[model samples]
Target: MANHNDRSGEIVLAEDKAVMAKAAEWLREGRGVALSTVTRTWGSSPRPPGSLMAMNDQGRFIGSVSGGCIEEELIDRYRQGELADTLPLSLGFGVDNQEAGRLGLPCGGRLQITVEHLNSVTSIDQLLNRIDHGELVARQVDLGNGEVRLLTGDGHPELSVSDQSLTKVFGSAWQLLLIGDGQLARYLARMARMLDYRVTICDPRETFTDPDPLPDVDYTRQMPDDAVRNIAARPRTAVVTLAHDPKQDDMALLEALESNAFYIGALGSTRSAAKRHDRLAKMGCSPQQLERIRGPAGVSIGSKRPPEIALSIMAEITATRNRTAGVAAT
Candidate 1:
C-alpha cells in the first residue's frame, strides 16, 4: 500500500502532520525545536523523500525519517548542541554499506537529511493555521540563515532542495463525501478514514443508524444534494453514492457532476447504471459530463463481500488520484 513518494498507510501521514503541529506548538511556547526532513533517498530507503520528524528542547520527538532506526541518533546530536546553530545542515546516513547494515537500512539504502533549527514561532504558527484552513502552501527556507517564507502553491513538486535553499509544498488533506449510510458505506468510510481522508456521511433517511459511530467523521441528516452543494468542490475531494436508491443517488450525482471533485462514483449494476445515465441525460447532462460518473463504483475485482467491494473502490480512487497527479505534473 506504500505510495511511490511516501509510506502507504494514511495513518502514518496523519501522524507526521500531528508531529508538525506539535512542533509548532512547542516553538510558540518558546522552546527550542528542530525539524528534520528526508530530503533525498536512494536504494530502498524505508522513509521516502519529504518525510518529517520534529523534536523539542526537552528531547521529546514525534514522527520518523527512517522508521525507528535513525531517530535516536538525531536526537542525541541535537541534545549535544551539534545541531544548535540557526542554519540548516544537510546530513547523510547509510552511505557506507557497513554503516547502512548496522543502522538497519535495507540493502545499503541512503538518505539525505536536512535539519533546521527553527527560531521563528510566528512563521510556524501561520503555516499551521494555513494548513488547518485547507490551504496548499509552499515553505521556502534559506539554508544559510534558516529564514522561512510561506507562499501560495499550485500543483508543484512537494520537496525540492539545492545547495542554498530548500522548498516544500504542503497540500490540504483529502476529503470524502459519502451519500449513504449503508453497511457498504460504513466499510468504505472506515477505509477512507484510515487513508487520511476527511469523511462525511450524508443521509436524510432515518433507516440508517450505526450503534458504533465512527470517530472524527461527521454524520449529517442533510439531504444528499444539499450536502454536496454545501461542501462545494475541490480538486482533492471525492464524492460517492452508495445509497442505491435513485431518489437519493441521482440528486447527489447531478450536483457532484457539476462540482470540481476529482472522482464521482455511484454503486449499481450495469443495467441500473445505464438507466441512471439515461435519466441524467434527460435532466440535461452533456455526454462528457455523464462520463464522469463511475458507475459500479470500483475496479472490476469480482467482489461480493462488503470489505472487498470497499477495497476495490479505494483502489480505483487511488488510481485516479495518481493519474491526476501525473497529468498535473506534466
Candidate 2:
C-alpha cells in the first residue's frame, strides 16, 4: 500500500461520524492498517475509554488516544510495521513514576489501549452502515485472536474489557433540533456540530431570514410540531427552541415535551417561563411533561450576549445528556 500525502499533519477525531468510514476506506484501498482503541483509563486520562484511532503503515493516522505523546509513540511503532503482525494485544502506558513522566501522561493517569490488525474491511463497513442507518450495535474484539463480532441491539455498557475480549457500543450520531434560525440558534448549532451532533434548524416563518447560514446543519421550513414528529424523537435527541416568538416556540415545546427527546429547552426569562407553562397547561400539557422543558433554558450564567447564551444552553444540554443530576443553579 502506498502512503497518501493528503492531510499530512491533520489530527482527525475518532468521535466524529467519519472514523469508521475512513477506516474501511483505507483498508479497501489496500493499506496496511490497525485500529486502536482506548480500552481503559485510570485517573484523569486525556481520552476516555472507548476512544478510537486507526493507523496505517505510513504512520498516517486518525483519531487520538492521549495528549499527542502516546499517539506519536504508537505512530512510530506502526510506521515500522510493528503492530500489523499482532493478534489483538493490549498496551499499557504510565504505570509508574518514570513511565508516566516519559510518556507525558497526566500525573497519576494510566491507559490501556488495544490494537487490532486489520486484513478485511467487511466488519468496519458493516458497523458504519448500521450506525449510519440509526441502529445501535456493539463491536466485540477477541483479545486473543483479533476476531471481531458485531452485534445489533443494546444492553452492553459503553465500553467493556474483560480478560478475553473488549466490547464497545457504536450508535448513530446524536441529533439536535433547533426551532429557530436566529443568531442564538446559529451559535448553538455550530457548537453542537463540534460535539458530534447532527443539527437541524427548523423555521416556518417565510418572513424570517438569516443574514448568514452555517454549513453542515440541515434547515427545514416545516412547522415546529411537524418537524418534531418527522425527526422521530429518540433518547439521543435534544430539542431547543430559540425562536423567541411565543407561537413558534410553544408549538415546538408541545411536541418536544412529549417525545423521547433526552433534553428539551427554550429561551426566555423566569416570568416568561411561568407564563409559557400556563399556556401549555391550558393546551393540555401535564405537570410532569411541563417539568421536562427547561425554560429560561441553560444554566444561569448571567449571559447577555448571543454567544454566551448559546454556551450556557449547550452546557445545560450536555449536563442533561450525561445524566449529571444536580439542583440546576439556573
Among these predictions, the greatest TM-score belongs to 2
- Give the per-residue Cα lDDT of candidate 2 at 78: 80
Off by over 4 Å in 2: 1-18, 29-32, 75-87, 95-105, 131-136, 142-145, 153-165, 282-284, 324-330
lDDT of each: 0.80, 0.80
lDDT of 2 by residue, 1-330 (tens): 122222434545556335566677788888888888887778878887778888777767877777555787888888877665679878998756676677666667788898888877888888878887888787888888888899964555567778888887788667899998888888999999988788999999899777777889899999999998777465578999888889999999998877878899988899999999999999999999999999989999886899999999999999887662111110
List CA RMSD, all candidates. 5.3, 5.3
By how many angstroms RMSD does model 2 differ from the true structure?
5.3
Instruction: Give each model a TM-score.
Output: 0.77, 0.80
